[model samples]
Target: MACGALLASACAGMPDSGDVEAVKASNAGDSQVRVYAVAPRDNADPEEIVDGFLEAMTSDDPGFATARKYLTKRAAQSWKPEQSITVLTNAPHRGQADRPGDPDNEGRTFPLTGRRIAQVDVRHAYRPEVPSAFDTGIHVVQQPVGDGKTKEWRIDSLPPGLVLGEADFLRNYRAVNKYYFASDENWVVADPVYIRQRQDPVTRMDPVTQTVKALLEGPTKWLGPAVDSRFPSGTELARDVRSLAPDDQSKLRIPLNGKADRVSGVVCKGMAAQLLFTLGDLTSVRVEQVEILGSGGTSLCLLTKGQAEQEYSPVREPGRGENPYFVDDRQRLMTLEAGGRQPDKPAGVPGPFGKGTVQLGPVAVNRTEDRAAAVLDNGHELRVGSLTSDEELPEAVVTSVAPRLEDRLSAPSWDGRGDLWVADRNPVKPRLWLVPGGQGERVEVGTPWLRDGTRIESLRVSADGVRIALLVTRDDRTTLQIGRVGRGVVDGHEEITVKDLQDAAPRLESVTAVSWAGPSRLVVVGTEAGGVQQVRYVQTDGSTSATSVLPGLNGVTSVAAPYADQSAPVVADSGNDGVVRLVPGANWQPVAKGGRVPVYPG
Candidate 1:
């Protein structure tokens, strides 16, 4: 009989007591078939009873008796005696639980639990040629106990011959439910319930074949070779597909956001060679203007195209207000203030003002909106004119009153807002000053480094105004000092001197350049005895720790933060190799060449 048919019949309720007794009488008709009435005892040893049943099944002597030990009447009647005892010469050796199976073994024994043998059925094959040891098949039914109560069975018809490997058996059979049986080699089984609930395709096709067919049906066609041009264009279909895909579709909507328009530029130095760039899209543009207070005075120079234009001239006298001024783009003329002081002379001519010097400081302009900020020298700052000049000359209005800064006031580099930082070497104490913008509060930071005649050669503020790097020269050696600027006038600043850096790395000469790597990281580039050294510092716990990054540079003159997209900083060396090598991640590769000077945004 087929396995399923046999299972159906055997799984039916046990035969009636009368039928069982009749079968028992017929089997006992032979004088050799002795049977005993073994009453069920509450304290019967299940192991001992099972051993007695095994002995009865295996023994060949006709005088041997059968015991109904622990089994119910129906179960005892279902058992049958072996007809012959021909022990197979090639029977497998029984193996220990941990050891691999021996080649000549019928099966091995494992500890049976209460739930494992709750219900059992036995079948006997009476062929004389077959070995008695392998003649019987034990069908064990496992009934769940404890929290779960499901019934399952293991049918032992064929000898266990490593049919399922130990790994596979443990993965499937150890769990009451065959939860792990559904896995393939690669992925875990997907949600079986969800998969079953989905409607199956009417015409079944392999997934690969279906994908290939869809690809062959061209994107424009909804089905087969017939193009659905009336439904929607191919471009529209592609757009819809992209829209349905993950991630933002707004990034894909190109040329709709805004067009690139020239905002404004200022000519620095002589307005002939160098120019600073501002953009209509300052959000995307990475470069920022680095504000520098010239030795002369502070004046706003708008760097655009190849020229820098002085936006508004500063008022030289203290407390004297200057008339509003504007710049004409087409004629390049400077008009006097409209309501304020009119020029006593012709336009472009200095009106009571000395030869006003202009510096390429920070200049912000909105070309689309035609708004601009013209930072002026002599402490005065103005906002003037159409950032994009049309017909009338763009006018300049004083927005900020000039602070009474010391002689030779250097323009403070703006960090974000309300904070202006400047480094000065005028006095014996050359320190960094943090001035609160629009409020005129000043706080000096950094330790006193300058002795009798020492001076500060250079000072640069970080992109974020939190850190100030200064190049100082004393009697012994020129040292670099880095200090942190606090938010207010409180003196809780932290300073790191060259002496501290020497303890970190001994072989160093002078710090030539220092720039902020990121918000909290600073890159120091200087000359050492070996060559040039580049060190990166991370601020932690109100202090800075330095790590040596690049060594053996042939005298680095300047260093700047890398371009927005680039990962490495640009270092200029006097070794004449005019190449901007990009250190992407960790590897160094040359990107741009020629201009070795570092250009920092204000």
Candidate 2:
């Protein structure tokens, strides 16, 4: 008897009690249909055992107990399903079974093949890769059955972890942002990780609990060097706690183990903030306050939503995000009144740039909206001036002599620390420079990867000043990469560098425009290989959900997002539609007739 035949007979005898559900059909295969694997029958063939084991791995069996039935006892004991995950573009294909050496041997090996698109390591960190060939093998051998009278085939050698198709992986896993503080700064950074959408089989923990555990485990490898966690070493949920929920007052109380019992009140409050931010989007529970409890169930510290915003938030003032500026037809700076009163009307900025005195290109405003930086003289000169007063234009803080205007300088950006950053894309001497307080002497930042004809086309500094988004062009192909911003002292002098570059949008063949949409998300304009243009949101860890892709647009030249406001619209410059903005649940609406570049203060 085969595995499928045995499963059919066993299911026929089971009683059906649950409500009958409908499975909607679509062009894309439905992931709602649950899969349940059955044990391989006695005297099963090698091919049956191999196929049955693969099918079992995709089912909902607890601990994959059914899958182990088709594997040898030794193999089952050594296999660690949670070690890692390999995501394929589709279900793996099995090749014909063949004996290792002798044709009469009972052992046979089957090859598993597919196109791998991404991988999740033991730490639950997801890394996207260019689609590539995936090849592996599974070996099975004849084994003795009851009383050693009959022989059964069982998998003897197999991979250590689970392999899932894209659709199934999407259904079973969810992307979550784990919060960690910037190494030297108090601001928290988002470290993305994937967890089971449903209850984890081995841990038997709910989704919220799983995310909390992952957060306590600390940051991912790529971001570990730049961020720190407030949770004490070896700190975890109190033993015997299975689920967490808020009380009637919307306050969630998290009980930690003994390791966290000795922390100071300040450190405890930081831990509460980390917990609040980490669980912000993971659950529907309205958590207005987080109270940390010691091992003995005594409250150590408490942090409210309002308190976290005022003290440990990325944006100190919520009002700073309302002023979004853009470059108009006359090459002047203009601001949109987005405070629910005359939302579409454009007003002139209060300075000389608003009076059209200087022809500006790409522009960036300081976080306080009191200062602005622009590329003047067709990108050859970088200028910074006050936006609140009609003061004379300041001298050029930086200049480039690249022969062509296009190769002179990229857009200028301001981080939350009031520092200015820009890249000179000159082929002869490419460099990245940072100006402290937008007035200090520019310090050249080292970028070792900018070599062999590779130049930065554009760059956006994250609001935390700990990460930067770069559009790097090499061999005529541009890709979006996120690099860590390191600031420290080297041999007596202060040093700043951007290092540990990771591809943030691996699926896009080329990226033309990119901006930081939130702490851990980016709005990018790019296209996949052999595909049309697209606008999408990609996580810093290189993961995207099914709904990440936005609606189609004609042609997007630049994209900008407000880091402080999640409700603010995404502004973009379109060649065919002029300036437009995409608000939630609405289509793109025209903002200006000839606006070229729209930007929100970082």
Candidate 3:
């Protein structure tokens, strides 16, 4: 049960003389170093006795010898042959007897497991008996354990008495044999316990000790005041109510069948506020509504199931199947399924679905006459109906066309843009696809080099549709490549490499997004150890500078420079805490409290 007993038993096979010599040599430079002895209990198992000896050294009972039995042979043989170990005196006590007639219990008695534990507190003293072997200041304490019956106890487990030394006592002794066995008798005492504890000066904070007081205490002390402080008046409650609709006179409707109180309004963008309503473990709620702030402002627009019916059609034709589509009634963006239609089948040939010319269904948004578009998943595009919807979508007008090579037909951008860039990771050709604008055709950009297994971690396009920035990572190193829209060669295009910018700011990990900060300057948002970095580039003069805009953020995943003045910088962080923080200016202020932000109104 002794702490060192296990380690001692574990290293028991090590040669005793070599271990002793090594310990002596390691202590040669320390004048105060001394060895203690332990006595073995009568009738104790040899293995258990050795375990107890090691345990006393380490202030634990199971001992080093017993613990060493479980170690691999390589670990046991790695001990130095010429190390010296200290022994401690024995303080024995009897063990409690087991209950009578216990089937599993043997009549074997042992030492008191708790009382046998001891500590040989090593004290480093300055004086040395031999000036040549020991230094004036360096001192060490060594605690050696042994059987309870003899004062000459075999060293088990590393003696705790050795100060500023390795846990591997034998190894230390072998490395510094010249300093071994030089003890100071003046420092030796029958009992060497109860030493005063010292506190770390740099980190410790003592209210009474003004001279030793830390400057700012711990790290939490620096941040705790702000995190725990109260918010500005009405700022907390201002975000409580749902934001009013853009139009003052619009009506609001509830989409689901539940209590409105269950919904929690998280954020408001322009006139619409995003709400999260909780129903039960099986269901959660999300709704965007327009709130009325005060007089003259419009009533909130809460879309109801009844109103949604007026906006959507649920009929399925034999030739044209019905496609489920998502619609935001507030935004008037109607998503209708398209392309899942079938033509009459021929006499001998089966259709796509074992019938005839099949339609995969299409999604259309009602805007005006002759302007409706349909999207398909297989990279195909089509025109659904006239932009002006005089009636329900006409199936006969659907026309299929090749998608833009750079278009992603199936997965559209959340911003209602028909064309979204998606990297084709088909292994054969890694390329970028621009999902056709308004769903007509897709355009493929970039070279086949992407198919050669280069991973594109992030991609960003300039607002003017001229420049494209991509963060490509290979073999744990990330490289930023910026190219013009029509360019196939990344290096050949007008680009900025991240490696070149390391001289100015060394902590930039990866560039997430790039935007034009001004006519002659470009803003680069990067992920750094301290958080998001906002770098300003003067392209005309080739001058660049970076500032730590956001601190304590894990990484910046996305960045948006919405305003021309670069006053509003929107950044998304995908860290342990998934929060999309908006830093407006020099002092970064969080626009949204939590992760998901409201996308209505603005």
* Most accurate candidate by lDDT: 2
What lDDT is reached at residue 205 by model 3?
16
Tens-digit lDDT track for model 2 on 154-214? Answer: 8889876988778767767878888888887887887889998766766778888888889
Residue-wise C-alpha lDDT for candidate 3, range 188-298, written one tens digit per residue: 001001111111111131111111111101111111211111111122112222221222343333121112222233212111211111000001112223232222232
Q: Which run of 10 residues does model 1 get worst, by summed lDDT?
A: 187-196
Q: Any residue pairs clashing in model 2, and if so which? A: none
Q: Estimate each model's TM-score.
A: 0.28, 0.94, 0.27
Give the candidates in order of lDDT, highest first: 2, 1, 3
lDDT of 3 at 541: 18
Instruction: Please give the lDDT score for candidate 1.
Output: 0.29
In model 1, state the lDDT of residue 428. 36
What is the Cα-based lDDT of residue 586 in candidate 3? 39
lDDT of 3: 0.28
Instruction: Please give me the total number of clashing residue pairs in predicted model 3.
Output: 114
| Candidate 1 lDDT over residue span 14-75, tens digit each | 22222222111112212122222222223333333333333323222122223333333344
How does each model score on lDDT?
A: 0.29, 0.83, 0.28
